[model samples]
Target chain A: MEPIKIKLDKSNELLTDLMPRKFGPQGRLWVGFLLLVIIIGAVAYYRQLKHGLVVTDMRDFTSWGIYISNFVFFVAISLVGSLVSAILKLTNVAWRTPLVRISEIIAVAAITFAAIIIIVDMGRPDRFWHLFVYGRIQSPILWDVIVITTYFVVSCLLLYIPLLPDIAVCRDTAPASPRWKKRFYTFLALNWKGTSKQYAIIHKSINVLAVLVVPLALGIHTVTSWLFATTYRAGWDSSNFGPYFVAGAFQAGCAGVIAVTFVLRNHYNLRKYITNKHFDNLGKLLVLLSLIYLYFNINEYLVPGYKMKTVDGEHLHSLFRGSYAPLFWSVQIFGMILPIIVLLFKKGRKPLPIFIVSILVVVGAWFKRFLIVIPTLLHPFIPIQNVPESWHHYVPTWEEWAITSASLAGALLIITIFVRLFPIISIWETTEEKMNATATQTGDQTQFYGA
Target chain B: MDEEQSNSRRSFIKTGLITGAIAAGGLGIMEVASQDTSKKKGDTVKLLSPDGKIVEVDSSEINPQIPDSLISTHNVREGVPGKKFVMVIDLAKCKNAGRCKSACSKMHYLPETRSYIKINKMQDSDKASPYWMPTPCFHCDNPPCVKVCPVGATFKLTDGIVGIDNDRCIGCRFCMVACPYSARVFNWDTEYQINVVRFKEIKEHAACSTHVTGTVEKCDFCPTKAAKNELPDCVQACPNGVFYFGDENEDVVSNGDETVRLSQLLKDKSGYRFLEDLGTKPRVYYLPPVDRQFPFKDVEPGTT
Candidate 1:
């Protein structure tokens, strides 16, 4: 809870250093690569639209495929915006200042794709308007649509309102920037001269949004989980799915932040700003989130393991010892248990080791969504019959893989582009923290002498 | 008054014969009218008018062709009033001939890959004897498909049949997941090989009963046939009299050849519904396979 103390000269140095910088050759290549991947995905999606959902490996048996899993992953990763910004801000956490913008950018990007991937999964995308034309309140899909859109709007506001002052700073400092870039910043900054009234309004709006985003973020992920849990299928039919999904989402979001922080720190050379202490703190938070998720995983799996209801028994067997066992156990051990074990130690909480652990958590979380979706569908109550042998199993086709990878790349591209335009770390907030620390330190010295 | 009645009755008979001839002959009314000019004028055929009153007219006046749009768009949602349809499968009579499956496939124009009525080989446990179980849509009173459909594309009618509106279905396939019976199938690819001409003919007879690409389809309990008081295709197609279709409200069911009181048949045969404990309240009941028609020899539970 202690504010970070810094000299005025160092504070000014941090501000100028963290300003939006021009992309170097490596940054240009990365953006180009992302664009190429996105184009490939668009082409694949075009083919899907031209033909139908038939291009995918999904059949009557495994009706939902990688598209849905990708959607869940996006929604999961997006929860970090609220966790790192809204939750930490409200709780008076001081160390979260450097990571907030990165998390919010990631959230906005991931959520944008989360909405798109859902449409990509639809059988009749042309008739998507039918959802609005004949939407029923009873359907969980409608609830998801409502909450996700609400979350997306709230998240965008949360990302943008805080960026106003920083945008003003970029506008004032970057006179040599491109005409369009200057115009963009000028228009976006709303002519802010850092007046006290302007600051008050901006602060009040952000505070209101920060409070609003927490429950909306929770609702977005909880409702995404409900899309599956509301169903009668054995693996998906559990009251624990809501909390299970939220916990897993927090874990995944924290891992995303850790991964992004490490990259941004190296790429932007902001080592002085994003210190090892931030990684250590995030590492500990990851441990707590992973533990909570592990508890839910136990609750999710144990009851079915104990009762072994005929339908549930078959589903659990597939995850525990049958076809999905490798992916299942790997997700459990590496994604949850190993991360928990590694991050619990001081040495492992260091930046390098923790980054590795975060990568494992992320990759494992992606496959965990896959395990949740595909396995249960394969073990329907009735045995698979009268269908082609290929229908008996699901292997996502190349087109499906292309589209799913494109969505992931698309999320990354959005983050990359946003970082190119703005500071990954909040300059105004960091400076405010430094000033507060100075005030607190002088007050402590005064008290010591008087006593 | 008597003389007037006799005149009207004669004319009604004449109209009835002309209409029937045109329908049976598949000849256009204009062709028939032109041909009638060369025929003998003395011939008279008995006919009845739709109004129950007879009106004398030349046979040439009969128009056999009805406008396609005049084909009634009877609200398929409101089923046959005052009727609760049910089916009772006599498992004791089934011998795995797959006649019901083929008949159902043919009647519904289902592709060779899919069958609306599937004949599953079932055994309760490893120690139990296996038997052929022909499974169709249970038409549950509390259907999970109807409940989960976001657009009300699939619905359970009052007549105990669950039907799908292909035009309205957004093809989410949530209903397929909700259905425990695995009765539903998606029209994944466009069925280009379907006999479009025959399909069109069938569509004229049945409202909202055309298949489309990317929508879910399943056994509809042959509501089209049921509306006509005719046996569903599977009921009539089962050579061994395995399927009985009837109105549960009347408590009578017929297996094409023989009619039986439903309550009495169930009482005598110890009938039960599939997965009764699931509380789906299926309209289809099964008489358990006892006193088997064929031995459970060399037959696997889920193999053709």
Candidate 2:
């Protein structure tokens, strides 16, 4: 209690600043918009279900369309949880405290939609249970299913264990919260008193999950990449797909975190908590990830471009100077190259500019996934035959657009609701970081405290 | 005693006639012929029933129904055992008449837009001569489609026929993507493509398993015809005798009219499988369009 009194004033300030707050009119409007988008998407999905996939423009040649691209986007974005939370946490990056919770929320939401969008792409979603009942171990798709589920569980544990103390804080500090919210906090807090034993268990559990999540995260995206790479198609036949996907996922994920943190900072008035330094550090991280992904992109495309094997030539020709060239170059330039160029500057790392760049990175990543799945399918080894000329090209139907938009909105809804219910930043950990920072600067050994 | 036995036999015949009339509306001429009491005909055939007892009946009385076992789901996946099926397409003979495509589509009840076989007009390069290439499922020995099928719905049978069980297919289209030949097509809106009457007709055929609405469909190499030692529809329907069907195990193939040794034909013609470098081990072979039966000048290179 003596040490508590010493740190009480600073800790209370953190609690007041970082605690979850009621949404204002603007927040309510945002939630309403997300809900409306989700409803529209659900209605589109219903039509797709009623009329089969024909409602979409997916034919034989362009069999896989934007739904698959959307699935890849969700999976790629979800990897942010593992990158920011598990990887940074293990590396002892102290600045990650405020970003970890947001990353985890994005991960959970994106992954949940990823699973949904894949089902949406299926010809027989009613038989989705067959994936489990009759799933074969040999298929890369089964491997993706297994690892994604594992990653989801590990990410949830990682998000939840650290949240126990915060939930307890909400329970004790906000008595005016709804009775259901109080009951929820009380149940989830697991009676956390912030005692030495509770803190020890929480720390140990988080460390284990953080360690476990790294391989699982890598496995999920790598398996997803293998879904394309394991096939004999031109664009997807590269051996570099696994690492290429993982690297691109990291880039997309970091961009996602930047965008989300920017929104949270402005909306919740959390500018002091998520300061410029976090953006600067994140900007640097984004550049490193983008550079790595750019390297992989070279490995993925350059060899095939050089070899120019007949089938690979057709696929590369399409991607380079054919129908898909515009998209391919745009994704490369905007998603990878431009982000690297812009974020290298200090001024570009500011919140507003970084947010704008992040949007580009994220949108480009979505189209990048589209380019990955569709172009390879169009340029099969054999020439396109007597099928309809339209089959040779793909244009997503209104149903496809609606459904894909819905999934994105669904992910945003999850993140928005999570921000409403829980502290977007980890309160207890941020306070600890503050206390340590204060002690170091003042050179006062007596002010140091341990949980 | 003889009179009593004859009277009882007559009564049995009368009861059978009444029941048969109820079941089949009216007896055919054959039934009347077999039941002719005026002629003392004594041609009897013995048949076994479900009870495992052999009963004697007149040969004309035996109107056979197709065995229930033939249409069972298990037989569809098992395929014709002890036979390794293969096909050889002579590119020189093909003029892209499109009869093979129509024959295949009609037999499989495929819609006008879809076909189990496609006559691709192929030319290796600007210098190379154009030829009509009728392509079907290769039924590859190391099938990429089978390897990637997550549910084991589409599988390679021991008889060298790659078959798809539409009931088991989840319609993920992974198999469609995995097929390098572009042989697979999804039943995107099968209900509209194939009507209800034709759907039931397809179900009765063991080889051409009726496609589900959201599942995959492809050329199954006409396993139903092959099981009966008959040529596949495409092989039989080709006007120029382009397609040759055979059992690789027997080493002989026939083009409806002409029979030749598979090994000898390949040796003489220098036949090769498509995309041999891919190592798919396709069952469909091609004889180079050398010594052309139809000149490359006749058909435009990219038209049909």
Candidate 3:
């Protein structure tokens, strides 16, 4: 086992040091941009609700659109909490300490957005309670509700438990902050005194939660996939769906973390904390995920492509050579293949290039979900007849676009607010690592050193 | 004796005596009536059952009331108590007449795009002869839609008719996706605005769309009409008696003009189901379109 050691370090920062700091000019501008986009989306959604789903291009043939894809994206991004915090902790990977809190915050924000977006997709948003009142245990959607709630609980505990010590550090060190803010931090700190017993209990609880969260994460995405797979539609009906969706989820999640890391590294001058090394490692993980996703993508499409089964053939043709072909091929190449190719090389794995590539993978992945849901529905085994010609096709209206955008903005705003309150990179964990490195360099150096 | 029971017995005897007296005089009147209206309605006659019970009724009266029992929607869905609702479409009689489709669409108040019944133009293989097959909700015994509806909004009825409880639906449309037959439709918008007078008049007979914009809708087998003990509008409307609806329990089905035993019809006509390999156990059956009564052109584009 690695050497076990515990040492006390005091941080006497004031509350102002921990409370929300005002954004700089550039930060304000960035937030303003996201807000403007969100507002536009909101206005669009208002029209949709008033006029009905007719605002969007989506028709009976294409009942779902960009909104469902966005929902899938949020659900995918939420998986990072389990991967970074729970899985890493259970595996005893020490390097993951700095990333655990960041990943958990991202997880909470993404999942919250996921829940919201699903409701937005409803025809009668007011009937939301019907799901609970009449919920069937057999439905995959209900399973999703149950498992996601469980995941949210475990993730919140994991995030909160680790923050107690850090909250104590901020509480004491940041006393110059406003009185109310100070009280808030102090309460959140849970009077952590760094005792051996307290540390042991915290560690044990975290370990237990960590062990439990991975499967719940797997369950959430698997159930989401089952929503489509359980259907008899040509593209969605496949046993390969569970793993295919899981792989795509991890790929999207890893790219999201990369994007967030790059932005934080540049804005906060977190070079020492979120180093090039971190970027390179995350890039390698992204590549592995993209490759795995590619494998599943092949199975999802190519096997069906091979036989061109009578029922499945028309759906496949639409994806391969019809209206959706451009988007389909783009997602395959840019979302999975290109990212995998670029990340394989040393230069391409650098922070800047990986950031560009991550954005592509994420955007491309969103469109991939759109393709997965819509094309198959349009090609029901029977011919499109008897109904109006418009019913034969689907186009989403402006309101759908607005609501979908607002949901995205809402996710980002939560992340922004969280960062304003707490440092994106864990300050306490960084300090501890620095202290350990120093101790190793000088065997008897047990004193604090000013930066 | 209970007052209700004694009153019912009294009325029964009175009706019997009046019927016997009418029968005695009806024979003399029938001879003259038959000559006057042979094409319209033939003579009325007094009849005795094979079991030696005497009951006076017209020849047409026996068959007309025979259809009455099957017409009741409450009884239709309960399916003659022990009977299962089943259909057998004779392909030979179908040249895509589309009478079934139009009757279903108009009766259900379906959105112009949504269809409860579909007429598929199919050829099993390039070498096989082409035929037009009309499809309705199979109302499968083992329905995939029932299995995946998270809200229990869509369910399989006892007599093998799948149904939806619109009030409880969350509009998730999971059932629409789950159905292999593509029988479901989501109400994307309120199809029409309702007027109080019109709504009240139609309310008891057909759906008054309290159309929750996102919930699903599909074929309901004319349950409301069946309650009145009348033939389903579709069965009555079809010029070609292509659709034969009956109870599997009672082993009989009719199209108002013709009645046949359900088992004999299926066995003799070589009826089969759609997608039988999936084991959905569809309540609907099809008769092969080998010698169509109407040519393929009878479908007449835009009629549907």
lDDT of 3 by residue, A1-451 (tens): 1222323333423222333466999889989988998889888877767766667776655667777778888888898888888776777765676577778888998999888888877777888887788778988888988988888788789878877766776676555758887888888888887676876777688888888998999999998898888877899889999899889998898888888878876776656456666778888889889989989988988999999998798889988998888988988888888998999999999999999999998898788888888787788766666666677776666677678878888888888977876656555555555667776886432222221
Question: Mind giving the per-residue lDDT tens digits that candidate 1 earns over A1-451?
Answer: 3333223343578656787777899999999998998899999998888777888999988998889888899999999999998999999887788899999999999999999998888777777888899888788788888998998898888888888878887787667657888898999988876766776787788899999999998899898888888777879989999999999999999999999999989889887778877888999999999999999999999988999998899999989999889889999999999999999999999989999999999999999999989888988777776677899999999899999989999999999888888878877777776576567775532221121
Ordered from best to worst TM-score, the candidate numbers read 2, 1, 3
Which 10 successive residues of model 2 chain A have the least lDDT summed?
Answer: A1-10
Model 1 DockQ vs. reference: 0.39
TM-score of chain A of each: 0.95, 0.95, 0.90
- Please give, for residues B1-304, the per-residue lDDT of candidate 3 as tens digits: 3335434633544465557643423332343333223423555677654456976765554332111122211222233233356777777777776677777766766544345677778777898677877777788898988899777777776556777767677776667767777787677665543343554455444332334566777777665554344566677777888788776665678877798887778888888987787777888888777666766553444443
TM-score of candidate 1 versus the correct structure, residues matched by position: 0.86
lDDT agreement of model 1 with the native: 0.81
- Candidate 2 TM-score versus the reference: 0.88
lDDT at residue A83 of model 1 (Cα atoms): 98
User: Can you write out model 2's per-residue Cα lDDT over A181-244, one digit (the tens) per residue?
Assistant: 7888888888878876777788789888988999998999999999998888888887899999
Residue clash pairs of candidate 2: none
Point out the higher-scoring one by DockQ: 2 or 3: 2
Candidate 2 C-alpha error for residue A96, in Å: 0.9
lDDT of 1 at B264: 89
